[model samples]
Target chain A: NAGVTQTPKFRVLKTGQSMTLLCAQDMNHEYMYWYRQDPGMGLRLIHYSVGEGTTAKGEVPDGYNVSRLKKQNFLLGLESAAPSQTSVYFCASRLDRRVYNEQFFGPGTRLTVL
Target chain B: EDQVTQSPEALRLQEGESSSLNCSYTVSGLRGLFWYRQDPGKGPEFLFTLYSAGEEKEKERLKATLTKKESFLHITAPKPEDSATYLCAGRYNNNDMRFGAGTRLTVKP
Candidate 1:
């Protein structure tokens, strides 16, 4: 069902350059999240959407912005990329915010900023 | 601060060897514990979820057990296909989920 998919599997950006990452899910999930995984850091949430039009900041939301204008898509934007922003980003979705619901993750997008 | 830590950052075992990976967490209140398997260059895949102490779940050759402050993922008769990073997570009262650094397991044949 293409549970979740992210665009541009890999990307390289120069400092100050801006770009947006697209995330899509066909599972009709009620919750979606954006997280960055750095070596030895596991995954840290950048932002999340509880529903189609609601977005909220998470543990590590600085330097990133997000929009969930549609029910099936979530977008993460970097206004001015920096070397510290380089990492593997993942998008995940869950049927609901219930504790028992397991999150489904997309392949991930690797970004490198110089 | 909520935190999740996994022990034995990496492990290598023979194809038929059995072992357990540990996940220790500290949170205000526990809601759920999760286990995920991830391959190189890929996102994590869900494996099991345990809700409370004494709860246990099994899938194929893997079993996950939960306690008050920690969780354990037990692998039995592992195969090469089981080589990957195993992640553990904990959901707290505020719905914030914290993940561990993950245990990289390599099962050699």
Candidate 2:
């Protein structure tokens, strides 16, 4: 089974452009997260969903919106893409928020904002 | 503030050499520590999870140990394929995971 998958593996956009990155997981996890990794910066959480129909902001949720209408899908939307938003995005999911539960991750989507 | 710091930003070792990488973190309330291996441009792959001091987990050539303040990942007699960026993350019981910049390791044959 594909544990976790992210769409638009690679994309390039210009300032003021809008785009959405989709993340899907087949593990039936209750927690889903979006994170971005940049050089010299560790992965930082963007947004997260505890369960269907519930979304919460994380460390770096600015410049983005998230919707979790389905149990298996989490959407990350950028209303006005900027150079600072250019980074490799990763999707992660966990069965529970309990400590030590492994967080499965998707391959990742590399985005570049010009 | 929650934080995680990894040392030896980069490491190079011979095929048969062994070494350890350090991950020091200070969180609000320690819950768990995690280790992961990531290849270039790919998401991280889980390695081990340590929940308490003196707790250790091993897989093949890598071992992870955790203490209240820091964690260590020891690699023994690693192979070329073991080359990757090793990442460390930690969280409190609340599931607010924080990650370190990670250490890039290269095992030459």
Candidate 3:
């Protein structure tokens, strides 16, 4: 079902440059999340959406913004890239909070900001 | 604040050897504890989810057990193919899920 897919598997950016990473899921999940993974730091949530058009800040939402304009798609935008933002970003989705909390993750997009 | 911590930042084992990875969590109203295996350069793959203390789930050579404060992922007679980073996370009723740093497992064949 291509559970979840991410665009631009890899990208490089200079300080102050902006870009958006797109996440699409074919499973029709009602919840989607954006997370960044760094060495020895694990995965930290940046933002999440409970449904289309609804978004919430997560543990590490600074410097990033997100939008879920469609039920099957979630987008993460970097207003101005920073060196600290150079990490592997992952997208995840789940059916619902009550019935199934298992999140399906995308392959991840590796971002390098210099 | 809710948090999850894993022990033995990295582990190496010979083929056929058995070991366990630990994930300890501190969260209010724990709803579920999850286990995932991630390969190099790839996203995490779901393994198992423990809903309550004493809950156990198994898949192939891996078994996950949960307690009140921690969870254990037991690998039985592992193979090289089983080598990957193991991650655990905890979800509470009040907030989003929190993940541990993960334990990188390497199996030498």
Indicate which candidate wins on lDDT.
Answer: 3
lDDT of 1 by residue, B30-100 (tens): 78899999999999999998987899999999999998888999999999999999999988853457889
Q: Sort every candidate by DockQ, greatest first.
A: 2, 1, 3
Ranking by lDDT: 3, 1, 2
TM-score of each predicted structure versus truth: 0.98, 0.98, 0.97
Off by over 4 Å in 1: none
Candidate 2 local lDDT, A1-112, one digit each (tens)? 8999999999999999999999999989999999999998889999999999999999999999999999999999999999999999999999987776889999999999
What DockQ, between 0 and 1, does each candidate earn? Answer: 0.76, 0.82, 0.66
Q: Which tens-of-lDDT digit does each residue in A1-114 have in candidate 1?
A: 888999999999999999999999999998999999999887999999999999999999999999999999999999999999999999999988777898899999999999
Where does candidate 1 chain B have its weakest 10-residue lDDT segment?
A: B90-99
Model 3: runs farther than 4 Å from truth? none
Off by over 4 Å in 2: none
Where is the poorest 10-residue window by lDDT in model 3 chain B?
A: B89-98
Top model by DockQ, which number?
2
Question: What DockQ does model 2 achieve?
Answer: 0.82
lDDT of 3 by residue, A1-114 (tens): 888999989999999999999999999889999999999987999999999999999999999999999999999999999999999999999988773368999999999999
Model 2 docking category: high
TM-score of candidate 3's A chain against the true A chain: 0.97
